[model samples]
Target chain A: MTSEPLVLGIETSCDETGVGIVRGGTLLADAVASSLDEHARFGGVVPEVASRAHLEAMVPALERASREAGVRLDDVDAVAVTSGPGLAGALLVGVASAKALALGLGKPLFGVNHLAAHVAVDTLEHGPLPQPCIALLVSGGHSSLLLVEDVTQTVTPLGATIDDAAGEAFDKVARLLGLPFPGGPYVDRAARTGDPAYVVFPRGLTSPRDLERHRFDFSFSGLKTAVARWVETREREGQPVPVDDVAAAFQEAVCDVLVRKALDACRTHGVNDLLIGGGVAANSRLRAMAEERCGAAGVRVRVPRPKLCTDNGAMVAALGAQMVARGRTPSGLDLLADSSMPVTVVAR
Target chain B: MLLLAFDTATPAVTVALHDGRSVLATSTIVDAMRHGELLAPGIATVLREAGADRSDLTGIAVGVGPGPFTGLRVGLVTARTLGHVLDIPVHGVCTLDVLAAAAEVDEGQVGSFLVATDARRKEVYWARYSDRRTRVDGPHVSRPAEVATPDVVVGRGATLYPDAFPNAAGPLDPSAADLARLVATGSVPVLEPVPLYLRRPDVAEPTARKSVLTAR
Candidate 1:
């Protein structure tokens, strides 16, 4: 309602029903209601369950966001929603709610890409992003390398996982170690006191042959299989598989490859800043390694706080705020919730 | 009372505007896969036709389906949000009841009949009614052959199972206009703004897998 765009963002790309309100570059409120407990019993996210939870959580989250921001819904200047690269049904719930809010309030709607939102969230913490930065986005469903010329306008796809995502690999390895579902945080916790040199795990896609074809691409499925084989051999030989040591070793491999490639991309693109964003960005080792590696290489690593790193509405709002500031055209009410929406189309 | 109603329980994305007295305008676009894309635009068109805006709405009504989960959630999510923004009352009407209401008025032919809609997986979502106003049994999901054969049947399931529903009649789908009428008249039971999914989400607890740790 004011001169600065007051944006409301809805994110149902996965198990979280997140609603965030942002006034210009400053974040106002971030209200998130996660259905992670529901999916935890299933070992992973179920699309139908997630969709239903989003519907149940949508209205409440919206109210909470506006209340926290101390602003009425009518005060919002525009609405933003994560419209892609997620579960089909889950994305639809958010896209539908956002459309309705935009329609009801007579405001513009911005259907944004989930990946681009992750990259743009960084700008909220660290003032405007330096153009032409390399971003390594890692999460449960995706492990993509992106070149960001602008968050609102242009983003070039560099590479992605050839098989399993880094978070998914962490989950699978955690299960093998008898840890809980969504073991990214738990693995990070257990690996702290354990020895990283306990076992030598293969770093995926780092070999010269692999680099020739997939210089920026990642592969964790083979490493996951290698970890499984090693544990099985240890158990079969009547030796107890040390859970902590295995966690540390596995975590080290994933972090090493991620930091190594990210710094390499920064060097290759002649970009001075390296940004890490997504669920995996919250990992202690990934953060430390990126900071350490980028510090050595002189390409500053920018990662938003852990809350913004994982999926949430603030990220989407951050991207939407950029779109409004840049005077980008709003998407029509017929904005499609494309499950595979590419990062190239930042705001659809 | 300006009431806006919609249903995405089936492939048809329907919207209607009611100005407390009669139906002002209504639209239905039957596209199976475009529920998310078509719903807001459909509502926008109906509002434009009625020469009104979404802020002019006083109440919201939506079909909480014993229908598909994905499409059904679209309507509920939209309806709830619109209600929230407008600070209006949202009435959740049973989708089958809306079809039954339409059958009683338009066709005026019914007594102890069944209303069934397509429930996918080769099944139908059906409920029996003593008349248009009172449901007698069902709102259950089953194969067509498993449903009680009534002399009269209404809704899309009738078109889907011709042999079983020989007397398939009334409306093929529930429109937003009829849903609006039901909510306005208080003719049917108002439900919580949640899905009426008769089936649970298809998932199971992870069975004990033969883990490598157990290899010893």
Candidate 2:
């Protein structure tokens, strides 16, 4: 019996150096090493810090992934790497490492898109994506709505954040509240017990006039500012800032608009499946709201397990395996990392 | 031992194949911005020219620079990955040392020589070598005028700042053939295959910046 092709994927688009191996849809391994603690003191991911960490972690992650998968490196049929829409310095580490690995192993290489990989990751958890699906990808770097025709070949951007991304706002607000660096989970944790209606936060780009131009685009900068101003007013009047209430209200505003527009996109496009991916997809509230609202609207929601939702090599490898299964051309050894790569070119 | 050597630390993306005793093939492209796009193909060209499969390589050598971090990391990461996959030992040769090693053959012999590369921001990454093999002083990043160097100079820093490095001579950057030869002959120190970044990353702790928080 001919077994499925074994593909290896590398992801160093951000602070994590992730290596994943997959055989068809089965996720054999997803090994990752993060430089999160190193960047914690900086309060943000310093590009240089991330690039340095990737170089240090790339080999170890690859070794661990292959070992965990119980496959020799030579058994891998193809190598895949995230080639763009990330920190240029950070992306180069992965791209260069992958190029060398593919060259050394005499295997085909696939330079896949980070955003599209987020959408394709769901296939590993659930199954092949329902064609003509709507993908809402929200992370520290991007908050975009996409229409995926074929995850490996075509993805159309509906809209993206004009200012701050969804997860970036979480970090900023968390910092304002004296929370830790990542702040997304901290804000999520704080919002759970707090009342969502305590202080009404302005929902961005939802106004009638704003909707005319940015119906699909998100605007979280305004919401982030409103939270700051509200906290400022409370302090000016000698009222202690209520952290829980603010976190809850702010989280509610962000999630409300995201779910509302995502479902709207699904409904308008006559699509039944809405897939949520990216770092913010790991948020419990975002997942719950997406599932609840999509279900109510007669739309199915698919989110990879929280572990697969965030950046990881398995997602890139999953997309790559699909590319191989579909008989797509492999990327050349000279493929450059496109820092602003559009989601349209799913693989290069 | 069959050796593969490559360097992206300099503007030139260079790759070479060596069969212990002599160089088999070499490739170099002098585009500073295209290191990531060029290095792998450069390696492929050299291996193909030498009729070598990557599995035939018994070792890998890389020029770890005091060069710009982005380009330098490309070579280091590639070299490290290639090493792991090929199950071969990878050596990090100081980029400056490689330049000096080549200069010795070009200029015959020198009591001492200096090697420098573009450090940008009006500075140079340089070192003073007692010969081709023994580095006496640096691997320092400083303004060209601030460095007191031996009159014999090699590397792009001399070409870029001839006034500060007045008596410029020899190859301006490392040659991969020279890097391969140096490693095959064991003429220089073989450090761990990590970049020799002589400076800290240019980022300040969050404490130095004003917080985005409103004044309370």
Off by over 4 Å in 2: B104-110, B148-150, B207-216
Worst 10 residues of 2 chain B by lDDT: B207-216
Off by over 4 Å in 1: A1-3, B104-110, B148-150, B210-216
Residues A1-348 of candidate 1: C-alpha lDDT, one tens digit per residue: 447789998899998899999988889999999999898877888888888889888988998999999999999999999999899999999999999999989999999999999998887889899889999999998999999998888999999999999999998899888899898999999999899999989999999999999999999998998899898888778999999999999999999999898888899999999889999999999999888888988999899999999999999998999899899999999999999998888878
The ten-residue window of minimal lDDT in model 2 chain A covers A228-237
CA lDDT of B97 in candidate 1?
90
For candidate 1, what is the DockQ-based docking class? Answer: medium
DockQ for the candidates, in order? 0.71, 0.67
Fnat of all models, as shown: 0.91, 0.85
> Which ten residues in a row are the worst by lDDT in model 1 chain B?
B102-111
TM-score of each: 0.97, 0.97
Worst 10 residues of 1 chain A by lDDT: A1-10
DockQ, candidate 1, vs. native dimer: 0.71
User: What residue pairs are clashing in model 1?
Assistant: none
